[model samples]
Target: MADLELLDKSIRRVPDFPKPGILFYDITSVFVNPEAFKYCIDKMVEIYKDSEIEAIAGVDSRGFLFAAPLAEKLGIPMVLIRKKGKLPGDTYSCKYALEYGTAEVEVHKADVEKGKKYLVVDDLIATGGTLVAARNLIEQGGGKVTDFFGVIGLPELNYEKVLAPSKITTLINYSGK
Candidate 1:
């Protein structure tokens, strides 16, 4: 099994962030620790090195951090899935519901080529709304989503079920926060 206690400890938890009664798991703390950051990338590489992934599609901002390095290490291309209006070309967008409200995400239509295999990367997976949106965007562009990768997974929300039939890999999991 992949042990991530050190990386887990590196994450900072803030209660009621951006709103009341909501706990946020901030990953910026892990970025400050070189060992922890490298460990995360290393573990992700170890898991997917044999999967013949042709490209990595990182889910907006935070996912970019993890996907860029991993794409370089694996010698694959990186695609960006960003918030609506962030991309500057023809794009495909998907709207999904969030815990608080509804949100939309998009990706450049040309970035994902037909039949290409892509792995979606993000810092964490909570309700999985974003991941689902990202996947739909990729599929709309004719790309296949091989799996979903995350540094942390909040299982209390049952994201695993929400993303059923799609594989998910996370370094550490926290239950019943």
Candidate 2:
């Protein structure tokens, strides 16, 4: 198979998922492929290795899955941006509108350090609302977001609207129907 075809085959796509028109691109298939999963992380590391990121902040839920291994490999701390009230101690939060409604994400105040560079990780980027909220919280805590990385991206969603002043990296990009 061609390289692109091979890579796409390993990702499972669920149609009309989470809503009537959403197509969820799932990466569980990659978890079963050691080489593919390793390639995924290696690519991310290569891109951000020289970015001098002191911390990797992962958005709640799926973001944790990617940040854990990446942080271990890079030997940096990993902070969780969780759902409101999920974090212990002093926290900062940002609320945004989701596809259906509104939601809030939080991060501990102590997890971020002044003048430190950070990378935000999430499963995918649709409209970029969630990641933007996470980035705002990081910057509010004195951390700078060097880049936003994800496994998949919905190019049609116009991430630039939310990430206007920043850029993002993704292993795969899709313009779903």
Candidate 3:
């Protein structure tokens, strides 16, 4: 079993980060602590170890942090879902709304094997726009997404609604319980 207390304590909450009134759950703190980072990967590994997921599609930058190790452990290929134009060769892209504006994500067409089941991963799930966009790109490229995983989630924001019909899992949730 994973130690929820240690993982929760490993995260640092920054107030008004990138803008005012925003309480950012900084996951970089996990990087500085080996135990917590290992715990995270171990937990996620446990979650999907017996599953039928063929690949992991990680969202740009942060998502790669968690996905790479998970894919390695599962012995599956890791696909990168990057921002528009970041990937080379023929690509599939999708646009999603952000807090301030819209952003686009893309995946290399070659990375996606048609009809293979994929799992989308990220550091956290706040509003779900990015993950939803990632799912679209994967499907548009002929890959099917079986689930979404985040290290943390903010249910207070009601993100599940935006990501409706898709299952998502998170290790920690800040819902003011």
TM-score of each: 0.95, 0.92, 0.95
lDDT for 124 in candidate 1 is 95
Question: Which should have the higher lDDT, number 1 or number 2?
Answer: 1
| Residue 142 shift from truth in candidate 3, angstroms | 1.3
Indicate whether candidate 1 or candidate 2 has the larger TM-score: 1
Question: Distance (Å) between predicted and true CA of 11, model 1?
Answer: 0.4
RMSD of 3: 1.7
Model 3 segments more than 4 A misplaced: none
lDDT of 1 at 19: 88
Q: Per-residue lDDT of 88-167 in model 1, one digit per residue for the tens?
A: 99999999998779999999998989999889999999989999999999999999887999999998888988787878
Write the number of the candidate with greater TM-score, choosing between 2 and 3. Answer: 3
Worst 10 residues of 1 by lDDT: 1-10
Assess candidate 3 and give its lDDT: 0.91
Clashes of 2: 0
lDDT (Cα, tens digit) per residue for candidate 3, span 26-128: 9999999899999999999999999889999999899999999999999999999999989769998898899899999989989999899999999999889
